[model samples]
Target: MTLPLSDSALIGTCLAATALGLIVMTSGGGGAAPTPDTAAQTETAASETAAAPEPSLPFGAVPAAPDAVDPEFGAQVRAYLLQNPEVIFEAVAEFERRTAQSQGDMDAALVQANADALFNDPRSWVGGNPDGDVTLVEFLDYKCGFCKRALPEVKALMEQDPNIRVIIKELPILGPESELAARFAISVLELAGPDAYDSVHVELMEYEGAITPDYLEDVASDLDLALADIVDLMESDAVSTVIEDNRALAQRLQISGTPTFVMGEQMIRGFVPVDNMLQAAAIARQ
Candidate 1:
């Protein structure tokens, strides 16, 4: 008949089995059988050896000797684990829960430490409700497919909830093209204004073609902004500073991918559905 084990008992049994295996493996096995005379001599030698004083150890430490493995106990542990495989799954699930909770706590601390840079940076464009109770920050690269996919979901989130403030951080990690796109966007924000930057931001998110000077010029022309001035300002110290600062912030927050969202204290590492976002927002509000 099988017997159930408590969580602590189960873990203890597994640990004991591991230690037993190590001890059994290290202890030499299958020695030749001793003759009657050899057994008598071995007993005499053991008596003399026991009578001798043990050498002194530093710090009055006692010698640690591994215990002999109980074959019956090892068999029982093996049988229990095999019969109740669900226990392993339960243990794994519990481990994952704890790990996720720990990571969430660390992310919350990180967010709190860098709240001003994340939520109130003057360089980044602020959309949705600026005075909203809840703030959502996104670190994105224009060339990332996930970022493109996330744009609509973000838009829908703002539309559905008018009180949600959104902050955009340009993190161009894809390549030079992504960097150029970000530079152009930052320049638009600095040179023109938020309205112009907002228009260009959407256009860039929606644009499927390659990001080139010609394409950027066309975008500027459409917005009735001077492309020459934008181009000149794109490579300036002001634009470089924004990108550098964003990269530093991302490194500090351990964000290595695009479409990473910080909704309140929670950090969503990748693209998630709108419902999940709303749920996170709701949780954040509480």
Candidate 2:
């Protein structure tokens, strides 16, 4: 049996066979020299060649027998790719798609691994259904615009779906004032209660500028909560420890941005439309 030849080997074989054919043609002693009629026939052949159909191979490739596939096939593939460079873009797109799928899978696994800290941390403020079938844990910073945007969506979700629980984890990475704001929110939630905490949370989240002691006092007074008492609670170890624990939990879940939402086995980073959030909650129920 004949061994299968590589592209390069097949090309070499074709070239050798061509050279042998040429040698035999040139050295044939029985052949007569071309007459005027033969020369006329040669001219006719050259004229006919101009009208021949284009080869199946791309332009610029040397014509070869069908069996010539060693180095010649490699060359053909290279030539075809050079002519259509967009193939590279298609390959890159496929790679990115696969990478995104893999990352999503990994994030899901990580979320499952850290479910206890993510969904049931006593420090996190649990809103919506206290015993809801699905829990959506949000990592938030008061100063994050996206987080603020998501607040209404969170509220709407809770309103529309009474069985879906929302867990708030304060991740104050914006600045010192953000930390203070988170500390105060956590403090109010821990010291006063969820109702009071919800009031302070909405006011703080809606406030425009810097969150100072005087500003917080005004907000506290509006809710009939003493600012001094809230400040004292904010400064205490319990509130600080809870925020620190949340930070640690965020790190474990590979969360690096605010307004991240985790539910079921999926971790959604960045702000998404309310429809998508609702869809995620629905998926969790299934």
Candidate 3:
């Protein structure tokens, strides 16, 4: 006998049928009447089913199908998730925290592996204490506004703590002007030495005017250096190699912007105040 089912019973039956790999078909009215040949074929099939022998079952019983999910439990879980949406936020926050931590660890490893190139590259200028206990490396671009802002903070950091060694990596990623400025500075270092490069570095960082050949030549003239010689060396392969190496190093460290500082094992991206730099220096000392 067929019996009517409630909503819950219908849901349960659907779930059970799905788990049992059974299809539940419904019809609003009787289907088309069967033809004589169809009826005869159906009778023959039924007679063959009755004549067929049943296959042996394991332990004299048929295997059970997987149990269906409890409808009440599923409904309760859906309701709880909808009411407490903050649970999703909490999960997202946790995921971000773990991701940041993993990134930090990977960065530290990269720093350690490239320590010599980072701290002791003879081509790069080394400012502050030569025998400092801790080293702070900055990847800077002359055209970067934030790098200009970070200049005084870095100066203050070195002045306040004499034990910090600062290394500048000339990363001219901004455009033509930035490249011109970096090439000039490195060329100065190559020909006239670190002292002349220091003079040009400070002037470029503080100069408010646009970067051009005349501006660089004027700076060289002010510093009492051979403007013609520095300009000539700017496009030389030696100067180009220094910039190329710095770019490769930045790529390895995943540094895409200027004023990125590597204090010991910790990396500080973008511009930060002197206070934060000081704290990072202290942490590096440890």
The prediction achieving the highest lDDT against the true structure is 1
**Relative to the true structure, how large is the alpha-carbon lDDT of every model?**
0.87, 0.79, 0.82
TM-score of 1: 0.78
TM-score of each: 0.78, 0.70, 0.71
Listed per candidate, the RMSD to the true structure in angstroms reads: 8.2, 16.8, 14.8
What overall lDDT, based on C-alpha atoms, would model 3 receive against the true structure? 0.82
Candidate 3 or 2, higher lDDT? 3
Residue 48, model 2: lDDT of 89
Residues 1-286, model 2: lDDT tens digits: 2369854456555655544443344333323345688768867986888679765877788876654223333444445555765555565567667877998899888988898888778877888999999898999999888888888888888888888888888999999989989998998887789999898888877777998878888888888886777888888888888988989989988898898999787788998877888898887777
Question: Which sequence of candidate numbers ranks them by lDDT, best first?
Answer: 1, 3, 2
Candidate 1, residues 84-138, lDDT tens digits: the string is 6566557756766797899999999999999999998999999999999999999
Off by over 4 Å in 2: 1-75, 78-90
For model 2, state the Cα shift of residue 62 in Å.
37
Distance from true location, Cα of 89 in model 2, Å:
4.8
